[model samples]
Target: MICFFLFTGCEQVSKSIKDTFQPKVDTIAVEKQQIPDPVPYDAAVERQIEDAQRLVETVLEKHTKAHVQYIEGKNTDFLTNEKKLNRAEEALKKLPQYLGKEIFIYSSIHFYNEGKIRVMLQHPQNPEYIDNYVYENETWSDPEQLSVKDNIRSRLISLQKISFTNVAKAASVYNEKIKQIEGAEPITGIYISVWDNNLRWSPASINGSRERYSIELNQNGTLKKFERE
Candidate 1:
């Protein structure tokens, strides 16, 4: 499911970028060349996956720097830049396979602010989630209620279990509880969900509403950091 969310709806995005960027170039002497045929879905998915990985690496570096600046209580515009968003969309266009594939790997950044980086990820077919935040105060939140030390441990265990069966069971029970809880705020943050093809990265339903999980990062290019639980 996580894989589907990350890989689907990319073709439309790529086409939009091509259309938006095509008009800005000098055309006086340039002859129109035949654009190559669109690549196969598999190929496009692979390219997008690579790009997303690269973006993660870049964010990791910048996030590390942002951590320090945030600690010093200094102003930094590390996370709100347009270039990073552009790069993120560009990378999303190249992701090939979803996380439930034999070698599915998931990593994403949803938002960055107040010296906090929110990360959402699922490894392979693992059902357990890694949802957490790193704050400028060097504090962290296990949004999933996972302990830092046991986070990956649970994920590793999930990979060996039967798919969806257990998750579905959990969801059935959780959903009932969700319905009973009442609140005006919409459930907007990430949680476990069955939205993707393989039931990966299942974001929980909030206030009877399901939300897409987001990973946020904060940095100033000099100090980097992150949080995953």
Candidate 2:
């Protein structure tokens, strides 16, 4: 009788162990979070435009330094220290937003007399876009990018005759105007003026020899004019 009791107790213990070892099912609820919208290409385009402005400034700086050395017949520390100038040129070449296939890059001073300076990358497919650094007001998709042309002409016509400040001011104005047009609330349309002075070259003296001038813009950053001495 005691053996029978022992066997019965063992069977009961085995059943309890099996029940305890069984896996339990679990149910979990996870809340998903919503992601924010991505930045638009228009914003990227705007950023590119701003970058172009800075690049243009850098190009002017390099050109001016190189010009001064060439004019004075001085050994170009700039030419020897070609890292910065070369990088600046490369950056300009990459700036399609500003300098498109229609435009060409040339040595700023000698470019005037010399016709069609050599371009780094040409649009072989498009014969019209032969010059990668030159921009005609008549040709480009965005005329504002060609603001540098008028700016150059103005500097050339100045009584003082093509001072660094003149070029810088024009660059600043063009940049400011572009920013302004971009900032226009509704952006009905964008207009950039490249007016001609048609003034004869005369030897005029400037009071100060400052190489750059400040251009103040309206609401959107269009250049109103310069802060003259």
Candidate 3:
């Protein structure tokens, strides 16, 4: 040990000071925890969701009887590594309560955008009626089961994939979106949808009589879209 003293002798230093320069080695073997892959995010999903909301506004203007049930998609917030699925589970669970009895509900809107949008209100007791009125833009197709085409059959197949969806990591990602809107109000209705391998949902407050913000995410928790409806 080297020491510089103004006057005099060698004295004993504290044990903590000595340990600071010399660390003790451990003999135990420890296992490291494996981490999961990080979730992905894209601003495009948010934009698309927003666009869907705008369309809902136009749709409501012409048809006063219609309402935006819910909007769903997959998107992520890189900062928190969150799926940004905001209030998804809450909205999803609200749907079953809306369609209590088994009844085939018709589709009034079709998404011209990249992703698909399907609506269903069925005999709350049966699954067969869910595909009855499901259709594409301006063209109504019968429900079929196979092939990955854009027909109602493929849509049914997509809906069946929701069995693999998980919302254990859900959080509030719509707060900012709601605040960003011009005239958002208290939310009244929520809609849930199963699209292929994605689980879409939203926490929406009505902007007057229309929805202000909603978000969607894939089954893997990747955010697909965020918009107003």
Give TM per candidate.
0.20, 0.21, 0.25
**lDDT for residue 93 in candidate 1, whole number 0-100:** 26
TM-score of 2: 0.21
What C-alpha lDDT does candidate 3 achieve relative to the native structure?
Answer: 0.36
Query: Local error of candidate 2 at 92, Å?
Result: 21
CA deviation > 4 Å runs, candidate 3:
1-151, 158-160, 163-171, 180-182, 192-216, 220-229
Pairs in steric clash, model 2? 103-132, 103-133, 103-134, 104-132, 104-133, 104-134, 105-133, 180-220
Clashes of each: 36, 8, 21
lDDT of 1 by residue, 1-229 (tens): 8777666667778878988987565564354454566666786557655754554454456445543333233323323434443444333223352323432222433333233334444522345544333333333343332222222322222222222123223333334444555542322222222122223332322332333222221111111221222
On TM-score, the leading prediction is: 3
Could you tell which candidate, 1 or 2, scores higher by lDDT? 1
lDDT of 3 by residue, 38-60 (tens): 67777676665564455334433
